[model samples]
Each structure stands twice: as C-alpha cells, then as structure tokens.
Target: MMKKVRVERDKQGFWTHPQLPEWDESTTFADSKKWFSEKGLDCALVIMDGDLGEQWGNGEIDSCLAWEPEINIQDAYLVGIWDTEDGVVAMFAFPQIILEDSDKAAEFKTDISGWVSSDGRFYGKDERLARYAGSTHRKCDCGNIIPKNSYCNPCAEKRTKEKFLAMPVVAWDGASYIYDENTDKYFSNPEELVEHYAVDDLDSSSAMLIVCKPNYARQIEDDFWCDDLPEDISFDECGGVEQETISLLNKLNEKLKTTVLSYSPGDQRLDQSLLF
Candidate 1:
C-alpha cells in the first residue's frame, strides 16, 4: 500500500515543527509565489510531517483514500523534494490527506513544514531561498524616493532667494524700501553697504536698495535716489534743458526737496538748494 499521509491543525490553524514557525495560511500561498518569483524559481511548496498532518486529516478508518484531484500536489511535491534535500524532513507532512478506509493512517502523527522547488530540486525554508523573490521597482520624482521632494540641498537655498525677490512690494522711499515683510536700507557705496550689514546678514532682507549714478541706472533699475548729480545736468547744446536728465532730476526733486547740480569728472563741486 502507498504510504498514507495525515494532516493536523492547531488553535492557530495548523501545527508546525518546533523548529519551523507557523505562517498564516491565507497569505502563505501569496508569499510563497513572491518568494519563488524573486528567486527566479519555477515553483514553491510547503510540507509537514505525518505527526503534524493528523490535525488536518479527516478522521476516517480506511485503507484506500480518494485523493482530491483539484488540489495541485505537483508543486507541493516539488517543494517537498527541495526540503528533503535540504535535510528539512518536517516538510513532508505539508500536504497530508486522509485516505478512505485507512484506520492506521488516522493514528499517524502529522506536523507542518514548508519547501520550494527550483531547477528540478527541492529546498527547505532557507533565507537565501526567499532573498530576492520580489521585483524592486521604484517610482519617479513624485513618489516616496530620496531627494525628489524639492531641489537638492545646494539648489534649495538659491531657489528660495529667487522666490523671495518675486514678491510684491509694500512701499519704497529714497532711503529704505519695504518688500513683503522685510525692509532694506540703501547705502551710497559698497563699503557703506557692507559696514551697515554683514555679507551673511544681507540674505535676511527681501531686497537691497543700491544708490548709483544716472549712467549706471541706465543699465539697472533705480531702487533708490542718489544725491550725486549727472555730469551734464544742463544741456549746453540744447541750452534750455536736457529732457532725459531733467526728467530724472524732476523725479528725484519730487522725492527730495533739493537742487540738482552737474558735477564734472575729477572736479570738486558742492552746492545746496533751498525749497520754498
């Protein structure tokens, strides 16, 4: 007679060998698939000893038992072969089923075990067997990957400064300008600019108002008024006035009640104007 197998179950569902830990039967099959797939193996199986199998086997005293054709035993057997080869004898009881009129079979002890089959060989529950069972796919930028939430550390600071400069302005005068919630003070030269605020502290303000000559202002927007006059405030050729320089002087005049004077290069000239 073919060796009849037995099955058994514990309060937790199934009894396994003392050395072999019990796993949730529902997730066990899915985990087995993943375990095998990661290892690039063909199939996976789980087995238990007959002593552990009695718990799952039906209590029937029969010599010949009708095996369920629907239950795929091939994969289980393949896994069993691997387990047996690995010296895990407990795996044999994994698929124990009762036979009809097998009284002696019911008396056999059944225990739980697990196994996997790959390359025509069976293997026991070894860490190496399930090491690479799953695909390691990673998502793109928006996903939960490192350094994708914002610009990298170095770029983040520069981006933050650019964004801060784009904010709307509240008010700006000849001496100081206010943007967003920060204030910036103007200085006549780079030396004065550095003296009032340290280089590192400059980033604390939203903007810096630098006073420059009209010629310099041509290239860049004038953030504040410069007390110094243009080289040729009066248009000698036009005699009457120079429209561009006069317009710039008028704007500065409106902001500050003072006279405008033309200071030639390399010439020391100082003049004061009184407003009515």
Candidate 2:
C-alpha cells in the first residue's frame, strides 16, 4: 500500500503539509523557494508506503492532498485552488506531466485509490500523479472527493432545495403550487408562498397555471408551452388549457395590466413577434 498526505494552500497562500499543520503554518512558498535556490530541503521525504499494483485504472477519484516531490515543486507555480472533499486542492499553473507511451494493460485501468498522470503512469500510492495528470475526481467545496460534478451529493441536494424554494409561485385556497410544464412537476410558487408545500398542495387545487417567459419555456424540459403555436393561431385556439386555468389566466392578465407598460399586437409572423 502507498502512503498519502493531505495538502492544501493555506490562507497565507502557501501549500500546507497534511501531518504538519504547524510547520505549514510557520512556513510559506517563499521558504520552499529558499530551500531550492539557496539551501536544500533536509526534512524527511514524505513517501507513500504501498504500491498501486500493476493495474492503473480510470483517473477519477476523491480529491486529496497529493504528496509532491521537492523537484516537482521547484518548477511549480500556484495557479488557483478549489475546495474538494479531501481539502483545498493546491493547483499549479504548470509543471503538469505529459504521458507518452502507455502499457496496454494499464491503458483502460481505473481505480479510486490512486491517480493517473498525464503520461499514463499510474500513481496508485502517490496522489501527486493524479493532480498532475488532472484526474476526473471531483471535489466539493467542503473539501471531499465526490462524484463527477462540482458539489458533493449532500451539498448539491441542499442547493437544489434552496433554489426550488426560491422559485416563483401562486397561492390559492391556502395552497401554493407552480406549474412546471417542462417536468409537469409542481414547485413552490414565487409570487406567493406558504409555510411548506407538497404533492397534496397541488391536489387541493382544481386547476393550476404555470407561468414562464414564453421564450425561455423551451429551455426547460417537456414544456408544451415551449412548442410554437400554428402560425396565426390565436391564444384562444391554443387548446389543452382547462376552463379553470383560463379563468386564472384572465385574472393574471388583469393583474399584469396594472404593472405592464404596454402590450403589442405584433404581425402574424412568429419570427417577427419573437424578435421583440
């Protein structure tokens, strides 16, 4: 098995050692530069103890502090770091390795325990290879390796809920439901809010009306409103709307009348109307 150390750029803008937080806090990249140019590093070389075996696999992994060799660090410059599940990843502008010939056996191999370098070398034990090679391992802002996307699962879910709650809605008969024709799912109404909403809230309403920018409707999935009506077809001819929905639509238009500056009766050509 190989040994790994967690490392990150500290607030002072220098990579900190995993085990020696105090030492990292005491020193900075300036010290590392001095070690390379004027003096030499006399510290114990941080080495991994295990081997990744012959099978180097797909590079995606949890974010982690990689054990970097002093030689590699000498040529490296800090670019920017992002928070990962493991910790803050100390990114470098260059010093990236380029993999050349790859062994057929190792070419398609993928592993979570180790990182693969750009040149196709497997650094199962040495995580530095993963960072240098730009592995697919995603890091959450909280500093942990997660699945492919940016936020960890927990954070992602939380964000989604927060975003949903902030969406616009309508309040009727003590229930709030916003129609999302795209997903055909109801989200909280932005226009009006209740303490909490559920599927039951939607069931309470005889009919629901979804409102979205006409042009943006298509950007959402499964929104029928996004479908362009037949050329010259008036709003009345657009079918599928319930009588209740029509009543609510009229009410909404009445409300809009107070705030809207003007309404245009554009030419029948869909393209011409859409432009404005």
lDDT of each: 0.32, 0.38
Models 1 onward score TM values of 0.15, 0.22
RMSD of each: 27.3, 21.2
Identify the runs in model 1 with alpha carbons over 4 angstroms from their true place: 1-151, 169-193, 197-276
- Candidate 1 residue-wise lDDT, 175-258, digit = tens: 321121123343443345445456546542433332222221222223232324344442323344567875785676565544
Q: Pick the candidate with the highest TM-score.
A: 2
Question: RMSD in Å for candidate 2, one decimal?
Answer: 21.2
Cα lDDT for residue 86, candidate 2 = 34
State which candidate has the highest lDDT: 2
Q: Which 10 consecutive residues of model 1 have the lowest summed lDDT?
A: 267-276
Cα misplacement distance, residue 57 of candidate 2 (Å): 38
Worst 10 residues of 2 by lDDT: 267-276
